[model samples]
Target: MQTSTMRKARYLLLAFSSVILTTGLGGCSVSSILKKGQAEQKISVVPQVLEVNGENVLFEVKAQIPKELIQKKPVYSIDLVYNYGPKMVEPIGKMRFSTGEFIYENDKPTITRQYSFKYTPEKSRGKLLATPHVAKVNKAGKRGKTTEIASGVITTSKLVVKSNTVSLAPDDYRKGVSEPQTLTFFFDEGQAKLRDYLGTNMGVLKELIESNYKTTLVEITAGHSPEDADSKEFRLPLRRAQALEKYYKHELDVKSYTNSSKSVKFRVMPVVRNWDRFLKQVQLSALSPDQINEILTIVNSNVSFKEKERQLAKLDSYEYLQLYVYPTLRYADVRITYEIPQKKDSEIYLLSKKIVENRIDSDKLTEEELRYSATLTPLLSEKLKIYQAAAENTMKWQAFNNLGVTYIQLAQQALKPEIREKLLKEAIINLTYASHRNPTAQLFYNLGSAHHIQGNYLEALRSYDYAIKLGGRVEMLQQVFADKAALEIEIGQLDDAVTSLAYAAPGYQTLMNKALLYTLKGNYQDSKTFYEEALALKPNDALAHYCLAVIAARTNQENDLALHLRKATQLEKNLTAKAIDDPEFRAYVKTPVFREAVK
Candidate 1:
């Protein structure tokens, strides 16, 4: 059942990779990669030559044949081994042998030769050496029997010596060369010896065990192999490797997005070698009802990035998401204190975000494997040194945004208004396009804050309004209420200010103003109580202190008026201006203490 599901996953993965490169402005490119085509191999090496000049005879020669040969530089070498038969030799220069052009400019035959000379008969022999050509007898047999002479094979003129074709295989490669992935999983070939696999992949298993305790990270894993246990053994290895990858994902229960809510999807790359096995495993020959159900369940479970984006995009509240992909390595046997760096984790977060946001994005990645990108390119740090360079380079757009946002937030929190304003402006410019192009509530809210700080009230209001429209959660509503109310009060729209501030908490400065409203209505007792309450919460409420003094004087409360008058004077030193100008404080306008304080 698992095998059948894995086969389907591989088909889907291949299909995604083959999706033609299409641009938002342009249609699919001329070279639309067909999902149907297989992963064609490149020229692994070129023909080489080797020589062990010992005897007059050449014996064996070996060539580095291509597992899957494409366009390669046609080149061959003549390996001449002394005292050996003629053999072919593969060429070697700087370790790698091929130039990747099949047609060889220099067509030459590899030749090896051998020569033997007898001094007496079979027992008595003279040693002979081999040269570029056929070995020739320098001396005749000394005994009555003429000296028996042996020769070697010679090429046209390309120096064909005796063939002792012994291939010099490079240092032993990893056990599984085709799949150079760091994450590897082993099985009992076809058995479910869970304990054995757990013991074998000690590190993965240990990590998996620890993951059981961490609920934040939702892990998903699928199982696959090059071959099927129930079927032939040829493709089981690939299946096994995929199965392990899936297992870790499943055991870890990785959270699929920033919200840490949904389950991570499990997928497989079964019989990754060919599509025939891929198809058969997904759609097996007629099976029993239960068997078919199990197969379907597994097959239907795998999810793709584009598919995930589509699914998650359906949520109206979910404006943005991030995907994080990482390849972590662990030594099962060794104990090491290695920590995944903050920068690395940040990268994962950004990558994950891109994956989640890929729905709106036109360009989609095929597989999780990153390309080596050998084409001439500048180092990443160098490329990011300037804005122009960063703009010119598009590959690391996601990375740049990640770092940019972190810096932008830091700038806003800076003590220097100039620095804060500069960063906030840049942040708004960058994030405006980011959220506008893709649309995220968080980015919009930040833009609103920046604009508001820079005194672009209307623009700030617009941004805040849109951000709220995009995201209508309670927390988001709070920001809008606070900003709008403060702005209204600043512009002296006291009526609107009172209405807006109704939603604000009493602990705010608006409470002092609210107390004055009661005093304006000629409610002396209420004003006195409210001012006292405001002072109790914030003893340095200067406006409240001054208001209390005026209310006391109007009520003819000698002790209260004197105390509050002195208190307000101490708190505001500038209270004289308010007492003389404010109509509500007119009664205290000529108090001797107030006059002396002002003088």
Candidate 2:
């Protein structure tokens, strides 16, 4: 039974093999059907229809056999290449070709076939080339995530992979896959002062980098320039980019993109695309959130903004940076920061950081400057920085106080002793003017300090009392009290001086100064107490030891005093002359130890 079945199967296999050979031979069988100069050839397809439109059928073409193709059976197949658009196109699979029905001679054999093709409304023809058909994608998804959605197209144009692919096409239409990013910078007009606006943006970019600096291939660059009516400098775009680069390097420490990463191989091509015009058009105001949103909403509502696109067509250089307007102070404080495009929260984050890290107008700037110089500064610098703030037009109150403070400093720096009084008088000119111009407690306090620096004791006293009455804070009140105590000592109010120094010591420069005052008044006990306190604050201070040595010599403790004297002499070689010239040291002058210490 087994032999019978095996013999029967062999016969069946031979029949099947013959059938396969015949079908294969029939498919490749080709002959020229040229008659009466009418040239034609029969073409074969895999019988896979892709679409159907009556007689106009398209195919999931298996192969295309060219006219009298040499080694003709079928050598290889080509994958179909096409594009509905840049993102929309890819390779489908290998396809076959077909020849439209043609007439044959009366005696010739007859055969017929059909095909159906699939298509979307997107043009199969690219801006470059076109292919006839491709393998069925079956499902169109993201590139590499699915079968290549092919079309009948070929292109020579190329794009950096990381960058958004831009179509170089018919109408330069927009797809909007990449949104326009925005960053804000507030400029103190004509001052080059930087403010939080730009600083804040930088922080956001940094945050993004922290997530994956090397992997993200992110870089920040800036440019800056100014365009005033008087200057011919017009390279704004270049300047702006340079400014951004400088800030990133100095402030944020972001490195430029490197060629090692294909995603960021290209440098940020910041250029001078009309800096003069950009600055000229910019309103010198710090942008606010609402205003920025308003401007952004308006700008983004446009045809281009709605579509986040990098149009190859923009190379025509018709585009401009879009900036929004926000509230500006009388004299705007300048700031600049970075922004990651399309992310609103990043903008706010950088803005907050900018507020903490920067300030406009610096004490280092000239008094006549229109803006403050900014810096990578510490806390004390922040408090003292705005002292020289300038007026845009004029806020009577701030300007009034500013002028008052300026005059006072000028008087103090006036070196010639004879003209010191003149300086004070000039200071009063501004102080009195400020008193008339919306006077505040701060104004009164400044007036008091000016009077004191000018050596007008009674006038200084009156000003301090008035400043207290005008509602100053505890620290300010303490300062006034301390100054009053110093005046008491000058006039020989020793008991009163002791009391004042006891309360004011903490706020004053050093307890030693007051201790010396006590020593001059013959109060060794009080002097010693103060000297102890001073030493506590400055344990390693050489001057403190010198002061203590002078005290020991005063109260007849020669043996105890000699040790201190020797120590003071060793600490400061000039201790002897300092003691001899000091009135408080007179009692110690008779001591041989004091004389020896001095030598």
Best by TM-score: 2
| Runs of candidate 1 exceeding 4 Å displacement | 1-431, 434-443, 493-499, 505-536, 540-590, 595-599
TM-score of 1: 0.29
lDDT tens readout by residue for model 2, 114-140: 333333223324221123221222422
**Cα-based lDDT at residue 598, candidate 1:** 44
Report residue 558 deviation for candidate 1 (angstroms): 8.8
lDDT at residue 368 of model 1 (Cα atoms): 16
Q: Per-prediction RMSD in angstroms?
A: 41.7, 39.9
